[model samples]
Target: MSEFQKVVLSREITGVPVAQDFAIEAMARPEIAEGELLVKNAFLSLDPYIGSRLKGRHMSGPAPKIGELIPGLAVGEVLESRAAGFAPGDHVVGESGWRTHCVMDAAAAQKVDAAIQPLSLHLGVCGMPGLTAWASAHHLAKVREGDRVLVSSATGPVGGTVGQLARIKGATKVVGLAGSDTKCRTVEREYGFDLCINYKDADWTDQLAAALPDGITVYHDNVGGDVLDAALANLADYGRVILCGLISQYNLPEGERPAGPNPGVYILKRAQLSGLVVYDYMAEQADYAARAFEWIESGDLRYVEDRAEGLAATPELFAKLMHGDNVGKTVVALGNG
Candidate 1:
């Protein structure tokens, strides 16, 4: 009870990470200082950005050194607090890292609604991923009535939310491209996308072309490789592209990364490309969550999660995510202790 377990980056990683890339080690529980709270992390948010951060490419913050706890978002209960307005049992979400316990400054701890049925949601559909989807769709992409939308990684927390919200926003057609047929089904049946194309199929490009007879008006891109190229080729005039996540190249070294997608089409189509970094809209999280709550309750928005239990499972689950095997949000439950 006086110690904590954490997953630390154990070795330098150049490609997709494996369980061996991380080591679970125990450390003495430190006392909280003023304006700090000792949190018992209930869940760990596994993201591709964590991998990007270790390599010093992620823009959210600097890269963590080897042997340091992997820096990422988490939500947990405050077991002890030295800060005002936070007490034991209150729920909070922040960059708590991959640990069973973490000492966080109160200013860094954004308390969340303790009333949410599963607090883990604050790390998923109702959390950062949700905000990322909403902000880009509404503010950056300007998705509106009569627009045709296409989303890649369609079953993920970000992509799934984007497609559904585009539908709710009066988009004329909302199509998604997922890696597998199973994921494609989840995109359409669960997330309610108009059509979900399996990009792995031999004739997927033709399928995508058939699905978007009028071309895409808003393309919410997550995987930025051939997917982006295909979407670009099928873009309508004045098409908007939201660069929410470029997971396809996350594993490659800078020099080994692929070349740019077709640029000629951008000029010909008058394409609008914008990168959507979620941190820029942290100030508006509460507003997005409020609307998300209504949409969830009204059955207008939907999401799924691929979760594992305990700190030991975090690394493997993340590896699965990098392999494109996860259907939705990737999370690891560490317990209330």
Candidate 2:
């Protein structure tokens, strides 16, 4: 290909993301040099974490410069390789951004076995989002038998995965908090959460309390505004809060971010709140993949994808996801698979 299409940040975000914030541009196809590979992207992931990056607020690294490609995770096939250990037609997952093609160092891409799951899943449930849930719940939160767990943003990929994993790990009860009644229903009926509260409800806190009369022992938080405040209020003594994401505040102006899960509550309950960045556990990816794959094969873990067709649909899909219009993991198919 002489040229390829990619989305680039056209302006800095102020509040919520809008289509005007990004621009789709045609650029020359990337050239692979020695030790690098050219990836023809098939699927691009649209995750809540990318919203933080767009607002210049992500904890991971510096934000993308205006006019630069929007940073994201993607699954693709190696179209050309000048690197050892990879060849043409190999499926791989990497931080290939929102692009039709990318030139990446071979070391930056992980070869994926499509036989294990669908290729797009390597960008979603069986990928970073799934791994984040696995590590945060099982490792950071230390979920155990008989523990009552609560997860925020219950219909999203990470939250959905966390609830199921907590259930599989023998949590006595696993409840969820979602934005809408439909999402709450999906979280309960499809994801198997014991109960799901609609945060938009005026009586959501009461519903949460009713669902977990015993108090929450493990809290996996994705949204961090009122939901987090409510979760903290219900934490059992010595409870664990796995802080995986703060999607609620990601698009807000820094000064407008909500405060208070109240420090006094944490101290009074002696609760442990820990932040989780999946990259910290990269060394254990193989182990996680093995176990997650087994869970999928055995029908113990399930996932969903909110897919949009074509690269041109990415901006709208991302906007929809930010507005909670998406039901599961949001992905943009680029016609390469």
Candidate 3:
């Protein structure tokens, strides 16, 4: 293995990412030292957080530096190992960025049981998206049986899992807000959301209120701006709001946010608003995965992936995800011509 392909960010992105923002080229796969393994990337994540990287800001986590390979989380298989405790043909997941080949320390990744499920599941249901949902539902939101829960970006990876997990956790009604009518229908019919509203409709907020007669007790916020405003008004007393991602605000030009919403709502309703950084809860990742694995094994949880076929598609898929073009997790697959 001399070299393989990688997608490198060429410039800071201003708007919807164009092809010129990324360039894919071959580079030598560096030799692994002791305690390291060379992996062939399998699935590259295209998440909303990547949008923040393009703007040179750090909203929740570390910012990506310019001229670096755009950072990402992915799953891959070890092709060669010079490290202890790893061998050729072992699958692992980590922050390997967007690349066809990677050399990482063994401690940075945990071996994946490929036989238990499709390896791609490590990038979706059993991975960050799933854990994000679990943390929002159980830890941040404290959802309870008979609680009315609402989620925005409902067709995307985080929102999709949030709605389903709410149902499993015994929420009486799970209302979802999605970009399109098709996504709304999928949320209702496929993900078991009691009501799914299309954000494209001007009357979406009115529709959401009508559907949630009991008032929303837990809101998993993925989209911000007007949607967040509406959810705020509909929350019941003692409501819990879990701030996940603000996809709508991620790509806005500087100084674009208008002052809106009073902070007094939290005091008025005695609501608890929480902001979460998933990495802070890493200690519980294994426990979260164990529970999610049980749900997956018993067919109680469902997942979807929007897969792009090659390393060349990473940047394109990243833009697509920011534009809400993908349902569930967006991934770029590498390997096997």
In candidate 2, the residue pairs with backbone N, CA or C atoms under 3 Å apart (3 or more residues apart, or in different chains) clash, namely none
Regions of model 2 farther than 4 Å from truth: 1-3, 254-258
* Pairs of residues at least 3 apart in sequence or in different chains that clash in candidate 3: 35-83
The lowest-lDDT stretch of 10 consecutive residues in candidate 3 is 56-65
| All models, RMSD in angstroms | 1.7, 1.7, 2.4
lDDT per residue (tens digit) for residues 261-321 in model 2 = 6689889989998989899887776667778888888888888789999888898899898
The whole-model lDDT of each prediction reads 0.87, 0.86, 0.80
Query: Please, what is the TM-score per model?
Result: 0.95, 0.95, 0.92
Q: After superposition, how far is residue 284 of candidate 3 from its true place, in Å?
A: 2.4
Error of 1 at 117 (Å): 2.1
- Which segments of model 1 are wrong by more than 4 Å? 1-3
Give a tens-digit lDDT track for model 3, residues 1-337: 3348777878767777766788787788668888888888878878887777667554534655556677777788889988778888888888787888888778877776666466677777778788888889988887789989999999877898998898898899888999888788777777778888998898887898898877889999987788888998888999999988878877878556655468887777787889877877766766677788788788788777788888877777777777777777788877531
lDDT of 1: 0.87
Give per-residue CA lDDT, model 1, range 239-279, as digits (tens).
99998887887877855667777688889999999988888
Write the number of the candidate with greater lDDT, choosing between 1 and 3.
1
